[model samples]
Target: MAKGELVQAIRLLTAERDLPMDRIIEAVQEALATTYKRQYGPTPDVRVELDTDSGEFRVYAEKLVVIETQDESHQISLKDAQQYPGEPGLNEMVEVEVTPPNFGRIAAQTAKQTILQRIQEAERDLVYDEYANREGEILNGIIERVEPRGIIVNLGKAEAVLPLQEQVPRERYRITQRLKVYLVKVDRGVRMPQLVVSRAHRGLVRRLLEVEVPEVFNGTVELKAIAREPGSRTKVAVAARQEGIDPVGACVGQHGVRIQNIVNELNGEKIDVVPWDDHTDKFVANALRPAQVIAVLVHDAERRAEVIVPDGQLSLAIGKEGQNARLAAKLTGWKVDIKKESDAGGETQEAPVPPEPVAVAPGLPLDPADEPATMAELLERVPNEGRDEA
Candidate 1:
């Protein structure tokens, strides 16, 4: 390449690739050596070096002095060595410049491929470093492409993999759609950082609360625990660190706008914000919101509670397929046995029954065994079994 053009290209590469000048220079020097080796026979002990300041590449051959020439490229006669730099002795090594003619074209091709590969590798390392320290953070991204195993989300500077297990079951993806993803893990053991991000993680809700609620971000209110069924419902237990904060009200916001935003983000999923209490009975009662709990009998030894509600509130407290009780149990870290006030005769009991199929309508899921119900009430009966957060 021409001197001016080479210098300009180097400078441009250094700026555009965000790489140091020394790295580019080193790569170019290696490329020149490789090209020279490929073009010329391997008989000579070829060595390539660069003048960093002048950007000059010089190839040399170290040939041993021999009395009689065997291989022309590897051995030099004593007379020839003596003619070159320094007085040479028998069996001594000397450096001889061996730059070949018409080799710049080969060097150009080798250098182009080498420099581009190095640039791409450097970009991967940069992206890895940037995200490795950002584990457990919530990031905004756009759906870049759909893959067979998962979706690739572009997080501005990098792309993250959203695996099938981490996706909401019923949610669909459109190209270029923006989304909020929770960064659950970062694997730096590989050449590229592997980010395991999730949209279904319970931590997503916690992070969204931190973003939407100033009280949570400022630490006035702390989220004690969260039990969630992705794409369905979430039960969050929050408490105020100090007095006068009103943790539940603060999280719910004025007329429920703050919580509504989170609900909207989850595609209209339900969220129940409950106050956290040090008292197990009170905490358990509050955790089962929109359900009236008459009493909660805590068994410290078994780490369980027998919750008794009024007869009419039995189905409400147990929820559809016992989802409400299950989530409450998970949030409190206790096994819950919800029972009617009349069933409180026993202290220790198992999980609640299915309420004798409710008697409102028969043969259909969530329908009582008796009369017809409206669609609104039918939709409200959806619940998942209490499950541990993954």
Candidate 2:
């Protein structure tokens, strides 16, 4: 870059990165001086300056103008100091310009290296600043590469590492494909800061809803809690500030367009938008959506609950492999145990029935009955009028 180009680049960097201009200028000058000292001998009192307007860099040496020099390397005669237009006191330092001879190949290479290193450092800083405050927010980036452990996404200012654990299982990522991710962390562990991205975090679901639902972005609808099984299902509870506005309906949008969009982004992951309530019973009931809850018995002291569902609705409330009940517990911050009304009602204690002797047919061998027979068999053998006596 030309002298003017260098100055312009520095100015742009300072503005874009929100860095102090003096600090950036000092960084550039220090790098340049380091380059110079590495190639040349221990040059004393070396100073570098870049003209703010012209971008011209000047190298000079400052020396003390002394009547009797104690250190010849750093002190100059009063007459020489006067030549530099400085009123030299008894022991005053005067800056004098130094022009070295034949700084052809070495100077060019040093300057190139200095500029490149400074630019990289500044760029790293800019990237760090841009992403530091983005935790829990959504960002879109291009897929740079897919590694064995994760996918690298190139945000406009920086590249973020999206680890496999943070990604939805079975989601396909193609190079150069643009995708949105949740900013989970900004770690400054290495030379450059790392932007850790996630697709499975609950924040991702919230962010996607915020983008698609205007009411949420406008602060009219608030997301209370979210529970998600990445690539499988998610449940979000929301509340509306204004009366008569259904928070769940608002999030669902027209014909489920809003939720469908988010599902598509998550590779067809299912989502349930439920209304939030301060009452624990109502909240837990909502969390287990698409299932009819007969009653919710909450033990507030222990944060535990017993949810009763109709006998026919038992499987629906418990879900496949108990995922529905599990997510309900997470979303409502309670331990949920679901039971059907018949199961709960029929759990009364009764006297154990005596095992019947295996009947052999005329001395032939007999097969053992599995455990105990059904209650109907025990009641059937009893005479209708003699059951109470038995």
Candidate 3:
């Protein structure tokens, strides 16, 4: 390339990547020096300079300015230093200008390769630095392709890998599909910079909730915790700041519109909105949703709970395949064991079991299977069990 062309190229690169023009010149000069060493012998000390304005390059070889020199190869007399005013002082080296006639071909190729490599390395470092602090943040991407291990998402400047282990179960992926994912990890390896992305991470769910719920973002509502079986069900505990605001109602939106958006984003994943509480009993009771919790007996030392529900609500409390109970345990951070009134006490008779309210009444039978039993009935049926304030 012509000198003008090289200068223009450098200028374009400097502006494109926001790199300094002087740095580019230095990199090119170093590349040229290396090329020179490869072609000629290493005996000569070489340096190269470029004119920032003219885009003209000059190569220089340093030879010691010595008097009565034994070695003619690199020594220059004081007379020579005087003539070359820019030369080094007393026993110091002077830069002797040497313009290679036929070395431009090789230097040009080497310079191009060196500049490209430098830019790539710099770009990688930039990307790594920008995303290092963003670990666990939500990022939007398009599905570029699917490999056996996971899906490759094109996140503008970088390609993030959404691993199978990080994917929600039973979720389908398609090419060019727009999706939002959580950046689970940022790794710097020998080959390339990596951002391990995830669609199923609990953080993803949290982010989705934050996006959908303005109250969460504003700190009016706080998400205490989240327990998820991705692509199937998720239970989130939310709390409100103001006295009049209902945490559950706020999260659920009007007629469940808000949470539905988040669920839809997770491929129709079911979400159970529960209120957060400082009290373990209230929190656990809320976590086991749709199941009328007659009482929450907390054994704090063991970090476990004996959740008492009426007979009809036991199945609901346990959930299908124990999903409800499992999520409840995860949400509450407690080991929950469920029991019914009948299991606690009462004789088995051949007579038909009465309604829940009647069977669990004081001095009456404790039929655990009775549906929809009230708190009054449960206290009556507990026999000598203490009603401690949880």
Q: How close is candidate 3 to the true structure, as a TM-score?
A: 0.77
Q: In angstroms, how far off is 38's CA in candidate 1?
A: 9.2
Task: Write down the RMSD of all candidates, one decimal each.
Answer: 10.6, 17.9, 12.9
lDDT of 2 by residue, 81-199 (tens): 77776477767888876545543334444555655566667667777777877766899999999877479999887888887667777687789999899886676535677777777
What TM-score, computed on C-alpha atoms, does each candidate reach? 0.72, 0.76, 0.77
* Per-residue lDDT of 282 in model 1: 80
Q: Which stretches of candidate 3 lie over 4 Å from their true place?
A: 6-26, 41-46, 52-55, 61-64, 68-75, 83-88, 92-99, 241-245, 346-390
Q: Residue by residue across 30-132, what tens digits does model 1's lDDT show?
A: 7677678777777456776666456455788888888887886788888888888787778999887877665555655666687777776676777888897
Off by over 4 Å in 2: 1-28, 35-45, 50-57, 103-105, 189-192, 346-390
Clash totals, every prediction? 9, 0, 1
Whole-model lDDT values for every prediction: 0.73, 0.70, 0.72
lDDT of 3 at 201: 65
Candidate order (TM-score): 3, 2, 1
